[model samples]
Target: MEFKICEVLRVKRLGKKFYEIYVKYEEEPEPGTFAMVWLPDFEAIPLSFAGWTNGIARFLVKVVGPTTAALYNATKVGISKPLGRRAPIPLSTPTYVAGGVGVAPFLYMKEKWGGKILYGARTKEEIPKFIKEEIDEIATEDGSIGFKGNVVDMFFTKPKTRDVYVCGPYPMIEYFRKRAKEIGNIKAYFSTERPVKCGIGICGACTINGKLLCKEPWILMS
Candidate 1:
């Protein structure tokens, strides 16, 4: 289950604290599955698969804690094990709705699935140039990007696509969930940013509403 680091490529700067790190996995890893990254003198943490090419997998990591700090400092190679079930990409054409770092996983999927993306950010500076090109529409809170409003607000303005994939903060997910329910035709999947300490469902850190987030995420309806 251990994967070797084939290469470490810096894709872009996501802010002063976040950097998009693309590590080529020794073997091809599943999209939407996370890898448990081992860092020196700290706990192993789960990072979502961003994208992969050849034999590499990508991760969008934020240096927000001791373990992440150690990862940023490590110069030597590392390894990771795929831990959870792979999230399925909806077969129907999708309109991806992403905000902030939640956009990471979709960026990778967009490469393969070829779907329209609706990306939102706090300002023009926070939106990476690479992401801007990939998305079909863009919204900004500060009137610095494509549309001047929240991503949810723009959703009402556009025609309802049949499939939607949303990932971001809890509030954004909740808002989209309500909107999706109202639309009636659009199916959706949401990625929750809960802490996953033990990837095998023992820690219970990733439970939502009564179901375990890791094991029963898809069962969540409403």
Candidate 2:
């Protein structure tokens, strides 16, 4: 993969500890692709492409370790041109179900293909403001928001047999795969949440159920 030195055009605090970053990059990658963001000393970490417009690329950053913490405050960084295959999105209406930073990729998808969004978080405050701006509904486990339950549970309340895109932790992905079978005609696409070390498929760092995340299409149909 090619690397480009980019300037952090802007950074905005989303909600609580999350930060939304806009990097000056010209690459207009399709939805469901990821980029490897890194600094001089910090390690490279994969981030979902949030949005792209006017020579700028966007990403949602959550401070998890040194790499991400540095990213939150970065003024300049090196990013690999968008990697991974574009997620397969059907022409039919889609419902994006996201958790935490998993909402990043769907941001662009939502713009390209309008759809209902069911965003979930542990508490009301845990849901980022950017997500709130684009999402159609919210579900917080603490009952502090639109619905009082996990996103999966909220989705089941009135299941729409439409194109379903699932992005979250392993449990959420597995739950959707196992449970959504009952929802006949639910064309679900699942994204792996594992950390991708090498942008290419050689490294097994981001393998889930023997599937390599970086090499395979971003979302796997099940």
User: Candidate 1: minimum summed lDDT over ten consecutive residues — where?
Assistant: 213-222
The global C-alpha lDDT for each of the candidates, from Candidate 1 onward, is: 0.71, 0.83
Error at 126, model 2, angstroms: 0.5
**Candidate 1 ranges beyond 4 A from true positions:** 1-12, 216-221
Candidate 1 C-alpha lDDT tens digits along 42-114: 7767777778787767777766788776666554435666656666766777777888777777877777777
TM-scores for every predicted model: 0.86, 0.95
lDDT measured at residue 74 in model 2 versus the true structure, 0 to 100:
84
> Candidate 2, which segments miss by more than 4 Å at Cα?
none
Give a tens-digit lDDT track for model 2, residues 1-222: 567889998999987779999999987988889889889887788988888898899999887888887787788999997888888866788888888888888888888887887888999888887777789999999999889989988888875756788898888888777777766566778785787888788879888777888876455556
Give the TM-score comparing model 1 with the true structure, all chains together: 0.86
Count of clashes, each model: 3, 0
lDDT of candidate model 2 versus the reference: 0.83
